[model samples]
Target: MTQTGSYLYAIAAPVGDDVLGGLRGVADEPVRAVRHRDLVAVVGTVDIGPDGPFGEEALAQNLSDAGWLAAVARAHHAVIDGVARAVPAAPLRLATIVADDDGVRDRLERWQDGLRRTLDEIAGHAEWSVKVHAPQPADPDTDPQPAAGAPGAGAAYLLRRKAVATARDDALARASAVAGQVHEELARHATDARRLAVQDQRLTGADTPMSLNGAYLVPVAGADAFVATVEELRERYPDCRFELAGPWPAYSFVTVEEP
Candidate 1:
């Protein structure tokens, strides 16, 4: 027989049973609500036997399999994303499972204070992702060089190299400054903002280099203005390309304590 565990997707303020009706979670299992005090946990039953796919040992191995990870991640996020649409939800890390409802209650009871605060913070807000990519730095033109072993040949070569390096450095510095300006301007329109690490060219699959990867928490009412600000910045700074995606759950701002 497959031993089962409760796979927790998110925590929210008092979700009614009717709200979760017909909703499915990980493994295509029926979603249910487990309440503790004023908070409710969104969960689904999942197999976690010693040899089951989600068994601790097997889970570690499965995470390394791209296809398996992607499938599970999609399912997990789907549940959280759905719940978040109806309530101020604080999502748990993917694959958070416990022994049973009692365990889920224990987690809720233990984190009630923090959970309530997080819920309050996210009640009327959503997360937005913004990326700023700059055009690739232009290659420098080379000046005709003196023949090797000629007088002052080495000196001229050293001077040319130094000039090229300085020019490249200056270009990068300018790009960085522009990125900072854009982030600052956008922050003015957001309730909270986070600057994430820039992605590599290979990961972005773009010829241009990424200068800024940012997350912002904005009020639902201000969402339109926030998007407009992004568009405005795009026009104001033609040298940098801006990409915006959002109205998602406050993934970057939610401070849920791990079980």
Candidate 2:
């Protein structure tokens, strides 16, 4: 037997024909509305065959599979990319499928005004991510002193180790102070800012410890200015590594409307 799924495009306010014309879903499918009184859910049809993107077995397999995870991520981006061009949208979590159109309508009814306001607020803005990494300092190789009698040498060695640890701690504290300054300066230019969990140094390519991993929502007109501000920041903080990426879909900023 063949199964089916509702592929959500986005949750948006009730829009006119002109706005709907500009929106598309997976595979360039024209967006259609499933209305629930005050709110509307834009969606397209998706197949749920054995080999389809959201098939029951396929979903289960992705629970532990890296390749499956990547494919799903791409599919999600494609859908969001299309709709965001036309409307202020809150892209749902990946694979947020429902049984059919009725289920989509039910969600719209439950979250109407919150969805409307979220869409209005985000219209014409995009999300950008920036992170700062503090590079690891080169290890200072200290020679171990030989013990005179051997039995009491362990106690002396520990004392020397403690002194070295104290010095390193002082250095880390200074670096952290510098990082804080950078975050504060950058926050001044953003409409909204959020500090994300520190990513691994290896992934971030920062020389110092990661000082900041943050997301910002900036107006489209201010995008160039935002990039320029970040460039100036990079020039100002030559001692620290600054990594910047995005103009991506507003993943972190979007939230369900509250009653």
Candidate 3:
């Protein structure tokens, strides 16, 4: 016999049947709420056996398939985004699965207290991401001009390398100081702020190295102020660049861990 399950996306205040009826989740499964009192778990139907996309075996196989992973991730985000509009919600980590409706109920029951508290904390707020990058110094080897009346080849090459190293270190120190000030300025407009480890240049497709990657939880009403503050930072640090993205659902603030 084949077993079936539900993939849970988020938990929130009671979502009406009408609200759930209009949406679909992963695999185009209709979105629905499995309610236990005032708390509701948003779920989508899934097959749990080896043949299914979300199955234990299938998950491992698909992890490296970028296209498949992107599609599933987008689907998961869609449900959470829609739910957030109707009610304050706490989004679960991607690919959270339960054995059945009963399992969904049990998980919700265990998390009921935390869910309520999380909802209250996130009420009327959203998340924003701010990233700052420090420009890379020009490669000394690119020019490689021997200093006036200096020795040829070997000595000149060593001198150029040392100069490049010194410039790179100086740029990094300046960027670090600028990043700290930028974070402090942005935090003034946010209810909560976090400094995340900087992402690699390869991942960010950044021309320069990332110096600061921060997420902020800002009140919905104050979103404009938060963005304006980020803009101000850009002007303050013209050498370093900034990327501000959001009014995203409060993903950074939802701290619930699955039991």
Candidate 4:
């Protein structure tokens, strides 16, 4: 007989039968809830083996597999979206599956209060990402130059290089300052904020410089105003690039409680 594994989707408030209906997980498996006290663990079925944890060397290997990772991510997002429509929810990290429904029940019993607080805090709010980039310094060869052997040619070249370096440094410093200002201003309008990894220029496909990459949790009511504030800041700092996206699930803000 083939052994089975429990695929954990998300933890949410106890949802009604109607609310839980019509949702699917990996392989189009119908989603089900494992209830423990006031908490519910949305789950689906997977295959586990007697070798312990599945047909893999270790838990890490199983978790890192690309196809497995993608399935879990999709399942997690799907359940999170469904639960969020009905009630506030705290989405677990991708591939947070355990051996069976019992493990989920244990977790729910263990972390009930913290989960409640997290859900309450995030209710009716969503996350947003903002990234800023600045233009790269102009190349030296592109600059107008005097003919070779002109008076003070060597000295002028050194002086010009020094000036260019100074200007680049100054621009970088200004961009940093502006990024701080933007973060601070946005924080005032958001329930929570975080600084994320700065994206590399090559990845961004722009000669523009990246000054900031940040996430913010904003109430639904405040989203329009928050966007307007960002637009105003963009106008104020015409030299830098300001990009914004989302209204996504609060992935960055959820905290896992110790069991």
* Candidate number of the best TM-score: 3
Clashing pairs in 3: none
lDDT accuracy of residue 78 in candidate 3: 90
lDDT of 4 at 31: 78
TM-score against native, each model: 0.88, 0.76, 0.92, 0.83
Please report, in order, the local distance difference test score of every candidate based on alpha carbons.
0.86, 0.72, 0.86, 0.79
Count clashing residue pairs per candidate. Answer: 0, 7, 0, 1
Which whole-number lDDT from 0 to 100 does residue 116 have in model 3? 87
lDDT of candidate 3 over 1-259, digit per residue (tens):
5667889989988878777787788778998889998898999988778888778999888867999889888988899988887889899888889889899898879987888889998989998999989867656676658766777867777788798998898778878998899889888888889998899989988887899999998999999888888887888788898898987888888997666
Candidate scoring better on lDDT of 2 and 3: 3
Colliding residue pairs in candidate 1: none
* Candidate 2 Cα RMSD (Å): 4.4
Off by over 4 Å in 3: 138-144, 147-153, 257-259
State the lDDT of candidate 2 residue by residue for 190-245, as single tens digits.
Answer: 77777788888687554556767888887889889999988998888675677788
TM-score of 3: 0.92
RMSD of each: 2.8, 4.4, 2.4, 3.2
